[model samples]
Target chain A: MIGVNSSPPLPIDYLYNFAKELFIHSGYVYFPLLFDPDVEKELKASGLCSRQHVEIENSSSNILLRDRESWFVKGMSLESFVSSYEKLAPESYNQHLEALYKELPFLSSIDDNPITDKLCTIILEILPYFVSKNRRHERKKLTRDEVLELVSEKLNIPPVLPEHARRILNIEKLRVALNSLSKARPTCSKLPSGIVSKTEFEHWFSESLKAEIIKNERRKIKRSIASREKFARINEKVLAVLFFAAEKGSLEIEGFGFFATEHEGEFIIYKRTGEYALKDYYGRIYMFPDCRVAIRTNGTLDPFVIENYKHPFLQKHAPGQKICMRNTLLPSTFTAQNAIFAIQEGISALLYGYKYRKRNGYHSLDSIPMPGSTVTFDDYMVPKDHPRILRGEVLVTNEFR
Target chain B: MNLLDKIKKAREKGKASIGVNSLNTVIAIIEAYSLDSNFLRFLDASPYLIVERKNTGSRFTRKPDLRIPIFPLTSRRNYLLAKQVIEAIGNPYIRFSRAPEEVYLSKFLYRENPSISHDELRNYHFEILLRREIDKKKSKNRFQ
Candidate 1:
């Protein structure tokens, strides 16, 4: 449900690449990249600052930057980009900007000849540390005309003649087939429009415009979807096997495994419970409490701890506290298969990813005065079929949620 | 000043009339801005504009973009205010450079307590929004 997916994180790799390239090209010492309202909190928290509508790329998120700068970079890893920026001397920052004073590379005009399928068939790719990041409800606003414009551009045909709307798509002679309504076209206004993203935007595209494009265009979209399918598929299959055992009070994957599945609104949520071992970066492990993983089928929304468990990494504040899915990137359209893998990652991250010394997250689980240890999950001996879970068959919706 | 503060001080300051219903809309507008980026923090809610649909009378009333509850801030006032707000927000990583009436919500701060009459701003020509803040340190560096 847009209800659950709500406000997802922005494109980290895209922004990082955009930021690094901007830093290299802009002669100005500082510049803000205005984003859509959706990404405002996320970008601001990352220390990237700046300042919409379907009436093209309108949204609170789209208005993030109030400047002129390029945002497309072919390839650059986030870590390498950030590390390099960190290594740059203060003098180098200015000198670097000055180098572009005469020939601004970042400001070079772009060839907007439909940046669709042309870019890459190769690849695709947020943090939890920033608490209170703007995670608002999805403001999906899209129109038929805009979708038609994009389709027209991609198909490379003269503008559709008003006299022959159906004939154009029905021509059947065109090599590049675009997604079109079979018969009765839905009214544009009733059809929502909002994502200025190829992402959340893409999900919108896939769902709203489910027509098959040429292999070239679909390759890029398909590659992203396929990779995620691969990542989450393995997790789902593996967990199902392990969970089969866990249901009988035996083997549990990682610390715990899935036991039951239930329906919640539009989502099919799989539940995982057990004593999870969270090992900080220091190698010492802490048993986390109330470890309940309730992964909903909706791809965009991360897993939630059904027990209302709030940890540094798992805090979405949705129906149940949603997991942040830190570093775990999902394409705009999260498929059903991705949930289990995401659950696996959520539980695994809690297992060995924590850094005891730094307490690396937006909030700390430890109480004030440095309890010196994380919250304990000592009930490893608890049966996977403990009555607390089995008896509470139905999910009690969190009212404060 | 925030919207509430401005509405309170409107009569004392002899400011333009901000209708009662407009306050709700204006508050909604400011909330939109705050949910956005650092715009609200740098901006005060002084640009609360009341858009009443007037009859196309003796004069040709150009349709203001305000037909919808919200639209892009591409007017000159929008540009100037965005520049001022960006500077005031003092973000070390970003600097904004927008055009005149070309784009998003870089709202207007109609804090002109007395000068511009309501009639003067009662058309498409005027770009009124609801947010304003000035960081002296950053603005000084920018304007200097």
Candidate 2:
């Protein structure tokens, strides 16, 4: 039978409670077991008394129980004994034990021979600097040559190396250099083709070409105005016909009663009791004023009518019969009443008869009709048998000898 | 005749006319019965049988034949009688001249229970079952 260890130094509850409290404070699910003879002896010497027992048994369970109290106490002081752990168990100690366990092959190789230990020592010495150089390379943007120089200086390695390794190390740097150069000097093919140089194109567009366009536009406007003036002249001609027709009853000028040599397609007309030169075209006659009246009638009255007219010539030359007035000489304010008034005034002037009398007892001035009165001519009383007409006919029949 | 005897006599006389097609008369009878049970009970106890007849031989067979049945107030007789009462109540609201039997059953016996057949269940029993089913469905959908 197994005898119980030395009065069971720490009660099971106390040990379990202490372990639980430590576990809770550390927030660890599992903690390592620590049991060292020297550490236990030191603890005992220090007067931190704790019971200890030794047991040898066939099963691992008995051994674990025999050292349980010691392991707990030592494990509790693990932080303090960290340096002493190597001295206590130098052969089994390893700082990277967890890593070595994870990488079993590496641990096995290192454990197998001294050669691997030497290799690991060399790798450890250079690995940190190489890692730092690689980290710097990744962080900073540098040219390929710059990166190569930095790597060589940092790792204390020879700068001269295989071209492939150099390229591999500076691949990102090479790409960055190529990208920057491409942006700075873009390929000619990438620019727009068939384009003039910038300065020449801008000079042509702004100064010479723009001035030419403006000059051409002004010429076009002048040409348009010239054509418009021509069109207006034609339009005035068309409208002139209507204006003439509206003023005169007919286009014939003979109805205006003027005696003159009858040119072919032309005639003289008396307008406003003044002789006018007239010309006919296409069965229509146009008249122009040739004389001014001595006795002026009111300008607002129709100038067409000689109000005092009682002459046979005047009766024959009534408006719409042989000749008519264009009435252009009449004032713009002339209305139908003014026309009637002018006719009355003219007839009054003619009826009073001009103050000239012939020595033959025949009136020198022709008798004129009064306003609101009709003048009837007796065809028999006219001078068909007149002695003056016979003398004129005789003279016209005889030769000029 | 006694109440059962009168029902029997009415049934025999072919007077158990359940006009499922005419719901108004059925509803009127039901309402009348509800208003005054004595009057309906007296009518139920009467010996007159109201039997609907199919047209076959004559155009003048418009009136239902009044006769008496041998048995009265049995389950089968009560079912036919209840059906007649339901038809009498429901006929007026229906527009068409002819109505399906299911419409009568659905209105009177089924009430709110979408399940259950009026022909298979007694009127009073179906009424209670249908009310409970309707109440249960109502409670379930109350929140929604």
Candidate 3:
């Protein structure tokens, strides 16, 4: 039966599992190829593992060469492994795989082959050194010619063999897969602190949206607001907030609480009076209100977000939304009075529809019906001519700074 | 160098390249066109127009030499003017090759318009999708 659950341990299975274990530990997937010198001629004639001059190193080359050919597979060559394995019967291969899981405790539960494929690719790029018991070597992949040259120089043989090209892993694809894996893990953070910059916050934010792990009820929230396109908006909003906060040494996310500083590379979230803890891009958790400020928990208030941008304010202000006009004014700087004024202005604008406008070249004002009372903030005095402050452009200032 | 020469040199050097300010202008224009397609025609006819940044508490003025002015999109009229300038330069987002800058500008566009693909930073379908969104909105409004 192809079912691994009921399978018994087989010798081939042990070998297969050993190879997979090597792949997991060393980041390389390889198979053990046994080449007996007695059948070397016949094996070469059969055209399996077809590329390469195996060097027999000995002072007496002629005597050693006459002996049966003995070669072992110690390096990576996916094509060669596949070609060699193809000669094995399907039943045998399947049994071997079953046996492999039975023997290898760590991988015994893993049913997916794609993870192995992913590891193989990563090994190619960040391949570790070919270490010897006595010395350490630089990590590198040798081309067929280079290998052939080295072998030839060691044994003084002519080079004439076609070696398979090393398997190449797409770094971009690997990166994406790794990101997804981090998102899936409960306690892993995709973006750790100390890696993001002010300028890079937006990109990191986008990546975090795709990589942040969510659990139980939060996943439901994600689905409910699925049409709102919260991912892009939340990331953008958070990055903007974080950047501003970083600059000002502290900032408050209007409806959300205040944050004192931003951690270098982290996108954090603090759940406010909710059952679920806020999870950042890196699976770090911070409960709301109690630890709203920075603490020693996995969550840091240095760079904070409101429930990691799942809040209504972040989700609701996208284009085509009624509240889109509400975000017309820049976030106010954090002076106590300015904060209060900013909040008042924001509410007033939303309630009475005080629209933002660009100044035209003409000094003359165009009259539009004004619905709200005159609103002014920090040092931008109302003109006497425009008393009651109705029906003219309201210029924004850098009062927050 | 004279002020004009210095400004000319800066433009020539491409130092005054499009930024978030320019991006918001394009969004307002597209939004205006979505409200009314006649805005597109109005934009095509206008000689020169102003572009503005969101009021994020920064001091930004429309440089006199720049054809596009940096201002806030407070009214339907501003969006109309914004639409004119946006059409002048095919796609403002296209100019930035770097992913960070592109993400900053396009994230809003991508979320607002579902047709834009998130898998690729530079999707050729952006302009097409934008047009589709405008058409969809216009059609929806007609029924209302």
Residue range with the least summed lDDT across 10 consecutive positions in model 2 chain A: A23-32
TM-score between candidate 2 and the true structure:
0.12
Candidate 3's residue-wise lDDT over B1-144, tens digit each?
899999898888885543445445454334333434454444333221111222333333221111222433233334444444445444434322222222233433444464544443243333233434556778999999
Highest DockQ among the candidates is held by which one?
A: 1
Tell me the deviation in Å of residue A234 in model 3. Answer: 40
iRMSD of all candidate structures: 7.1, 45.6, 35.1
Prediction 1: B-chain TM-score: 0.24
What DockQ, on C-alphas, does every prediction get?
0.03, 0.00, 0.01
**Model 2: per-residue Cα lDDT over A128-218, one tens digit each:** 2323333564666554344334434543444343343323323344344334333333122211212224343233323332233233333
Candidate lDDT values, in order: 0.34, 0.31, 0.31
Q: Candidate 2: where are CA atoms >4 Å away?
A: A1-240, A244-252, A257-333, A351-401, B1-144
Give the Å error, residue B85, model 1: 50
Question: What TM-score does structure 1 among the candidates reach?
Answer: 0.23
